[model samples]
Target chain A: MSDPGKSSIPFISLITLFPALLLGTIFGIPHLIGEGSAEDLITLSGIGVTVTVTDLLFVIGLLLSASIMAVVYYVLVSKYKVAVLADSKTEELLKSRDFFLRLFDDSPVPYLMVAKDGEIVLPNKASQRLFQMTAEELMQYKFHELHDDAYFAQSRTIYDKFVRGVASSDVEFEVVRKDGVRRWVRLSALPYRKQGGKGKGGTISLLDITEQKAIDKVKTEFVSLASHQLRTPLSAMKWYGEMVLQGKEPLSEKQRRYVQKIYKGNQRMIELVDLLLSASRLEMGSFHIEITSFDPILIVKDIFEEVTKSIKDKRLHIIENYEGDHTNFFSDKKLVHMILQNLITNAVKYTNDDGTVRVSLTFSPDDLHVEVEDNGLGIPPEQQDKIFSKMFRADNARLKVADGNGLGLYIIKEAVESLGGEVGFTSELNRGTIFTVTIPNATEGSGTKSN
Target chain B: MVLQDTVLVIDDDNELRGVLQEALSDAGFEVLTAENGSVGLTVALESKPNLILLDLVMPVMDGWEFLERLHADAWGKGARVIILTNADDIDSLSRAIEGHGYEYLVKTDWKIDEVVDKIRGELGVQ
Candidate 1:
């Protein structure tokens, strides 16, 4: 309150000093009683006291001196108060700055403050630990020095993007530490403005995710090896089992049944392995979507020939409807075939004898929709929600069919979704289920997965 | 009469090789087996079989290498190759086909009797 221009105490002091001057009038009171004249008040300073108790000149001089002292006291007090206030304000600002600095230093996530010139402006405690160096030593090297040479350009681009607030949400890359070890780190960055400079910088935080990446890699490798190695033996068993049934001399009814059972068992194994392959690919997120233009009708015809005899023997009617047989779909042909195969296989497997399976395909400018409707034992209402869940089987589905592992719908769902499509169904118990999948036409547009 | 024609089975799986040899022989075609691609190539050159069933992914010379070597040989050029392989790598399979169109079969997808029938068809027999 005590900047000379800003202090309110000067006005209050002026008022208090004005009232003290009233004592000067008391000096005149003696004169007013006819003891002396007001003009004689100044003569007191020129001579010694004249022995009167109410000398006008003496009283006027005392009152004026006291008023001067009061003004001086008020100004000094206000100045002291202002100094105290400024001291505490500065202290509070310093404390908050210290708090943020400590937080950055103590954070477990490694942080690097990088200048636009690519120099390491500051390194936190975690960064020091990550790079196997002291903070001072870390700052001695540039940002790219802590990273592999292969990652320098990428790191620079990411830094620029981050400073501009345009980088991807999650950025992950590998870096070489000072200890000569490489590790993967997920990075997040924030822009930092220099206090009094035209330069801008970024503070990047790194979280080590090497262990998670390693685990994922091992899982993918194991799946690949199992699929590759298991197929050979399974192939042998299937071939031999089939050979026995196709022998020149026809076996008895009992022997034929046993051989047929073997063949069927092998087929189930193949189906399971293929399902595993798709599941692993989905989980690994490495399923490549190769969009090739092909006539889907030919695929349907092949599948039809494979299932025709069995459908006929069971007295079931199979119908294939195409609005335009010549209409070609631009999509991942293998995945589309898989989607069709799974839905149709489920239809054939779950339906009762003499049931009907109708497959109709509709075309749009942007997508193709295939609907597989079967009057099979449909899923109950409560179980419909979980039909696409892994290893989920309907109670009635299991009762009607005993050999299902419940991966068919899951694989179908994965394959369709990976192709940027949607698969959904509506079903009623003992009536029918209709599965319709809409896949975007890669012909008219671009998708995430194109080889 | 079918046994008059010889077939070479190039595969590393001993048990599968045994079963396939027995099946091919039962179908009346004489069968020769080798455990790896290199051994199979030597046997194939010496025997000069009527047909070759090449298995990919064998050690000491994979099916691709065997085919390359077979193409270089004068006697081997006339032999029809039927790739009986467990390798499911799509690019490799397609690339193998682009050079010389061979009827490739995924072993798991075909039965032994079916393999016999496919071989018979290639040989122009019933």
Candidate 2:
């Protein structure tokens, strides 16, 4: 026997080589038989030789088929790997697409994607609901489809500006819905561009502001109507009151007292009406202020002179404390008058007989601060906030005073704010209230002036 | 203060005008009345009244129009018009006195004697 390693190698090779060996044996046997055998083989060639040749051909064919199978296996495995990679890439793309779609769908504000030519490309669910249109229908339509012709034209202008990159933020507009419902919407848009500036598109967001617009409209109408109605009656009251007060007719003591009562009542009504009108104007941003450079001290002195008689009984003490060389500042003189009048009048109204009311004016380089301090029933903390509200009165003041309509402080606050000034107060129950007003100089046009 | 000096009351309210006439008569003055601004203007120009009580807010012609027309007329030059109006604001008062050249008196403050005294003052009666 050969060496152990060599013998083991042959055995292993034979196990793998059985088909090749069998094929070789069948074919080589005919050739090895020689001449006699060859003659016999020739005679039996049709059968034996054919069998040998067939066996050889089959062996060779099997070897060739194995080689072909190896090639096919390599090609199929590589193809499978490529297909798997392609599938995973497709799956990743689909996941990203779905994520963006979900984000667009879930956005709170109504969103619409429009092509460059104003065709609707996509609309979020909110957009569909707002316009009361189905997704399919909205995609087939444009923004003009839901608005009136006039508004549609306006929308085109705004959209054109957005396309040209001239406008960057949302613009407010009125648009009509498919159901003929008009609404106010704040529309914001972004220009969408594809790779290399090839494709252009726009995404628009619409915020419904109908409720706010309605509230403003109602406020304007109410102010107009109230002013007209209140002024008409106030005119009659003032005219008649003055006529009676002028002593045009002979009167007894009782008659004079009655006339005086009526006059006083009418005068109070006029004041109330004036305060109401002023407050309404303030809230509506229509209150007029004529800003000019004037001395705050002079204005305070003038106001004091005008209201001195009313507060004479209260022993009111008004002190002017102005800074040096800065007495002159820019401000609306009339508004200043009204502010001082309201504060001083309020002080007199709330102060007891013989109580003291002090008016002090303080100024700085950037601002003018006026403080009106009164020793009266101090405001309760709970009622402080409501004091600046129109037609609101403190409970204690309401119980004690007959002349106030709760509009004095409200008007004061409005007038102050309109002039770019601030009004605030400090009070302790049963102590006293001190109102402070800080206003910018007149050069800033803090007050509105009526033509 | 007598029949020679007639006081003209121009107002839109017929009831008010009638009451005014009666009150003026009792207060010892001859009174003439017109319901609208146009007719009141005609009456003022024709009668050459000692004093004219003009009411604003009339139907055909308002007090403003009447004042414009009356001020333009030669006969109405010397006539004193005490404006009977319901306007209370300083702007309206200023317009009446300065812009329209008239004295404004509110209706609610009206008294018979007061009206007569104003008329007497305008007429220069002692």
Candidate 3:
């Protein structure tokens, strides 16, 4: 077989020129060797002179036909090789493309390819279902378009942080669906990278967490209602028990002792119920706060006066260090009172007969700080974390007092947090405990403060 | 003090009321007992007892309603009504005392002697 590209032109030229050569020979040979006898020609040119013009032409024609056949064979072989290579390459490409496309389409989690500019470029079926939008509709929208204005801003900020490599974990945000219903979605994003490390765009995976939030809300409501219901009956029992113990009755010593036991038992039950209710409410986040602006100094004075009636023998030293007359801050008055009352009560209860409990109220421009320092059996370092937990009485406190339900500090912490405040304490066992409460100024509105 | 006047003990709990009646009878005053607020209000009006013990939670009419009726009725207006029940809270106790101007006592808290003393005190008996 001859090479088609190389042999075709040469073969055609040789075939055409061979014909002209044969014709030229046919016309010119007669003049050169004019009608002569074979013997006479043989004498002139020996045995070679016996050849004819027709035989020479036939030889030339046979050579031309072989050349043409070689050119056709080369063309057929080249075409077959090209067709085989093309078929194999196309098959390989189709298989790999189908595999990759199926993997992307069948992903369980909602996956979205978003441009760096926040536009939705490619969204899989799961993504479309998650956003409650059709594929064509999703392509026309952006990530921020899927949520309300406030949530959009928050989501954009989160995405920007993610793109900047500042966010380590997935972010949770509220997003609106096509039906305009809000939902919670957890998003994890990865930056799109090209071969040369250039940022092309990013991809985000979304997971819905709305059901968990609803369960949490319902639990909170249940705890709040139960607490209120329990308080009413407990209040009734406590009041009646007090009246019985204070009644004037001439009775035998045994009867008096029995009555005293019953009164004490009922008192303990009332305390346990109140603590349980508070703890449940705190756990459920059902406590309500009524924020009002009042002088912290005035609150301290009132709490001190109220606590003093219960602490007959204990000495309470209250120090007020406000720079101006209006040492006021916004807070729930009742909650603040309860917080101070709890701290002061604990101070007096833990202190010895004449031990000192000093309460300080300091005011700054941004915050109001209240400190209750008591020189009593201080809590151990190991038990500090458990002190604020419901029904968690420290071992040292248990030795000092046996009647506490271990809910005072827990309730105080919850109340403080509900009022957008912070509470902490420093203690050295056997030395003293200093509890510090820092509440923001009246300017901060009553909202849930996350730590 | 001889039995110069009768006391009406009105309470839902029969045993507790019986104990009060026995104790009050022993304390030199004749005592009458009623199971509910309506019966107690009736006895208070008919017997014209020197003192009345009222129960708060009752079947037909509650102590609140009985107190309202007693305040409006002609016969019960003068009777010294004291609340003797288990509903014992500052709010309820204060409402009973301040709202109705009646001394409130808890049944579980008060002993027989203490109840008698309260009755005698209200009766102006020495």
Candidate 4:
């Protein structure tokens, strides 16, 4: 098949006029030699016809020159158009480059382009504002110089790893301002490489998180103080009530009933105090896990027995599959107990009259999984996100029981997580909810799982 | 000469201390009570009870200080110390148990009778 472009337009091929000239010379020279050159003087014939050779030669030369000039004009104009197009493209690229440079300079976040050598390369106007120094002054110093001296060792190690293709570029760092005040900054970097795959420079954006850090510190302190102070007195209340209820003094029937009410009310107060303490410990990140090796199934059974009265009051059916040898995990007993208590209570409280509540324990070499599933008033899909949130109760749940502090799931989630386990639930409205907690069994070199 | 198993209750709460003293005495153990860690340490060293149920949060000297002082004395070493704490975190729990070789229990979680029972169990007494 012939090339499609080969037979297309010969007009643009006029730029190859050297070939055109070659053909013109080869063919014209032959024609001139064969036809002979028209030359000289005028001759008069008897019939009165006269002609000059110079006139005919001048006419022939004019036609040949016109043909060559047309091809030359086409070639010159096409080349000129190509040059203009290239120039326009260069101009567009320059405009875009300027726009992006201004955007970087004007961003609220401080931006700095850093070299693999830890040198501060290209710093924007915002970087100057953040560091309280001019670009010229900051440029001479290394990137880690802006960070607090305490961060030097770690920053150096991180930088070394980053360039060595081992570490992530995003990290939180502390920087001392020009005024000698420490500021928290979240530094995220975009690292790139050279064309040859060698590590190149990266750009970092610093977001000042000083205010956020301060707020977090205050929140932690408040939680720590409140939990300790509030629960101390409740312990006193609990013991005194239990003392009177179990005292050997003979009391009338009415008096005994009154004392029992007091004990129950005191018990409720203690439960509330415990809920608050759990919330505080979880929020302050001080919820301690003292893992002791114990049979998980035993703890589950004990929690079920503790909540038996509640189960009977609600008339809920109790289903237990706790048989055989479950795992003896090295885990925090108190935390696991709290988790089981919370989950079982939730199952009992949310379930309807005569609703089925099942407690199942399954074990493996690597992990132990405990699931508390109930055919309760299952949670709504929209409100599921708020289930683990503190003091959050579903609308249906609130209507059924008004006494719930709604900290049950929150405590369960925090306690289970403190044990280095995961807690998740599956629910359908008016059907049931199943909460599964999976904790890794520490049977190897590790002693106990604690947080 | 073997004697009756003696138990000491060191706690800040006047009511809880009184109640535990009454309960343990009823359980046929010689019950001794101290209001704070300062008096408790002295009493513990003097009486050398078989078991001591010490509450962690107390005035003057806390349970931790009492244990430190008790460990220093030769007589206090013979008694088995059990810290009954209201401190919620596990660090305090483990510190009370590991630091002094004491048994730890949460105050509200245990009934007054249960605390007495635990003391009796630790002492191998009725």
Identify the leading candidate in terms of DockQ: 1
Question: What 10-residue stretch in candidate 3 chain A is worst by lDDT?
Answer: A35-44
lDDT winner between candidates 1 and 4: 1
TM-score of chain A of 2: 0.53
Clashing pairs in 1: A239-B112
| DockQ of all models, two decimals each | 0.63, 0.15, 0.05, 0.51
The ten-residue window of minimal lDDT in model 1 chain A covers A49-58
lDDT (Cα, 0-100) at A325 in candidate 1: 35
The chain B TM-scores of all candidates, as shown, are 0.93, 0.87, 0.88, 0.89
| Clashing pairs in model 3, backbone N/Cα/C closer than 3 A | A244-B109
* lDDT (Cα, tens digit) per residue for candidate 1, span A1-451: 2355346555655655654466656765766678774445443455664534445444655677667767677677877687778878888989998999899999998988877654678899988888788988888876645666667876777656655544333477788887789888887766555554434766777888889999977987697679878988888888777767876677999999988988898898887887777776776666667777877778778777788776887788888888743475788888888888888888887778999999888776678889998989999998898999988999998888898889889988988878879999999899989999998888865444622
Runs in model 3 with CA error above 4 Å?
A1-174, A184-209, A251-291, A305-327, A343-358, A374-414, A424-434, A443-451, B1-126
lDDT of each: 0.79, 0.72, 0.69, 0.76
How displaced is residue B47 in candidate 4, in Å?
5.5
What lDDT, from 0 to 1, does candidate 4 have? 0.76
In order of appearance, the predictions have TM-scores of 0.62, 0.52, 0.47, 0.69
Give per-residue CA lDDT, model 4, range A1-451, as digits (tens): 2333333336544533554455556545545566534434356677685545543444455555557667665655666666567668878888999999899889888988888766788889888888888898889977767889878876776677556544354577698877787888887655676654645777767888889878976876776666666555666766666666677777799988997887788788778877877776776667655556789777877887888898888788888876434655666777778888899888888888889999988777777788899998899999998999878999988988778988899999888777779999999999989999987776665554335
What TM-score would chain A of each candidate receive against the reference chain A?
Answer: 0.52, 0.53, 0.51, 0.64
Better of 2 and 3 by DockQ: 2
Better of 1 and 2 by DockQ: 1
